[model samples]
Target: MDLSDKQQRPVPQGPRIDRTFFRQNKKINKINKLKNKIILVRVLTEILLGALRIVHKRNTRAP
Candidate 1:
């Protein structure tokens, strides 16, 4: 039996996180895992923003 065009076509699935992507992702996950004495949404955002600022500064100063 011959399949129709739609039936023969492979269905696209959701995003698959590859090993390389997961490697960096794991680093972030680990960082987040290191919890402080207090855990708050505002504090988390501040920590992330501070990290971004340091990264931005380092990149801008790079030769």
Candidate 2:
């Protein structure tokens, strides 16, 4: 039952793969990172704009 012992059993084989899979995975990871960065920048810009609007309103309303 203890598969931890390498002598007890050989490692199970997994799906066969080629270099293309690795290259595609790397490209996908890079794209994901780019998407996340874009999203973060967009969210930050929106927050800053909202804050600026609030500040402008407060300044205009003050006597």
What is the clash count for each candidate, in the order shown?
0, 0
TM-score of each: 0.37, 0.73
Q: How far does residue 56 in candidate 2 sit from its true spot (Å)?
A: 0.2
Error of 2 at 41 (Å): 0.2
lDDT computed for candidate 2? 0.68
- Report lDDT per candidate: 0.59, 0.68
For residues 1-63, what per-residue lDDT tens digits would candidate 2 score against the true structure?
A: 222432232334567656666676566666666766899999999999999999999999959
Can you list the residue pairs that collide in candidate 2? none
The TM-score obtained by model 2 is 0.73
Model 1 residue 51 CA deviation (Å) reads: 0.2
Candidate 1 total steric clashes: 0
Candidate 1: which stretches are off by over 4 Å? 1-39
lDDT of 1: 0.59
